[model samples]
Target: MDIDHLTEITANELTAAQYFHGHKCPAMPQGLRAGHLAMDFLSVKRARGGSELQAIVEIGDHHFSGCFADGVQYATGCTFGKGNITKRGLGKFALTLIDPAAGRAVRVTAKYERMKMCLEMPFFEQRRQGIPPYALDPAVVDPLIDDVVNRQWRDMFEVQTFNHYPVEPARESFEAVECAECKEMVVLPYARELEEQRYCAVCYQARVFRGQASGI
Candidate 1:
């Protein structure tokens, strides 16, 4: 379906997205638009499982951008649980959704002007004043969310399509081992060796630290 029709279909998805997101904010819906546009441009559906789609987001572990990633996660279905979301720690509002099977990708970035306008709003003014987003009045927040969700696609993002973008398929791990020390299951690739025994990363590090402290 075209992006517009798809967006119209998303009327119900927004409620679910908001529920998963734990409080309403504009950034998440802003990300919703971005992810929707990327998939629409690439002609791909919301990824189902096992890396059918990968969303590489430039937003990082920050105060402002975390919600944006949540939006992208909800919209693209490229989630941490699915292990399809990759964070670049770039601290910018950008998303690159890659369909490696098709050798295609599209990058979407929030427009600077729109971002600037959001920053100047009373909602953010309260944000900068140390009020949590959920604490603000819906009256103060709903208008921004409505505007972002209803805004024209072209006005919201700068989108670029990549006919061919290099993407390596992520390998899945089914093999697991129990750490000799922690007795906890760990994926094979993450198991560390200590004295010919399998160990999880945490237990392995603890052993290493003990050895160093005792001059082993």
Candidate 2:
């Protein structure tokens, strides 16, 4: 496939994404294509950090074997660390890219036929049988990867344009509070307030679990 026409991302970026993701599976490339398409359509630069762009992904917990969200993150720069990418868990291979300042947005989704074709591949059969992509024979896996990489972008996804997608304001400030149980300072956004006391996520979950176990 002509990688140049696929997206604006460089060869190095793709390679780095693969390296970080630890595989050359199709889902990552698919995500890369989606991200690039979104940015291109919105006429926006990749988010370096902060809330320059936001990606709302529709990938579910275990629907696809590949880490599709990772692909979107790599291509769009809307990473979890930066707090820009969110999973809607609609159980569909789709995402919405939003440009808050421009008031523009678009939803890109894998075409049903294309998704069916992918699922019908021999590689997907292996996945359905509980075989990991890396565990499969390279001979079988390489061809699948090649097909995904080489396929025309027009053949893969349908883009639905929208004006005025609700873009929430970026949280620029946070209150620091002490976790009552741990007595450690935590960002308010990351802390849970219960019964007039704040607890970190870890501590909150532990407390909830302990309460449940003891019939509290």
lDDT per model vs. reference: 0.88, 0.82
Please give the distance, in angstroms, between residue 101's alpha carbon in candidate 1 and its true position after superposition.
Answer: 0.6
Candidate 1's residue-wise lDDT over 1-216, tens digit each? Answer: 455555542668888999999988899888888888888888889999967899999976756746999889999999998899989998899999998899999999999998888899999899889999889999999998899888888887998889889988899999999999979999999999988999999999999999999999
Those runs of model 2 whose alpha carbons end farther than 4 Å from true positions after fitting are: 1-10, 189-216
Instruction: Name the 10 consecutive residues with the lowest summed lDDT in model 2.
Output: 1-10
Residue by residue across 1-216, what tens digits does model 2's lDDT show?
A: 243354554668778988978877778877887888888778788899768989999877877843778888988889988989899988888889999888789899889998888888887888889988778887877776666666776788898888978889888656888899989989878899777778999899999899899999
Number of clashing residue pairs, candidate 1: 0
Runs with alpha carbons beyond 4 Å of true place in candidate 1? 1-6
TM agreement with the true structure for every prediction: 0.93, 0.83
What's the lDDT of the predicted structure labeled candidate 2? 0.82
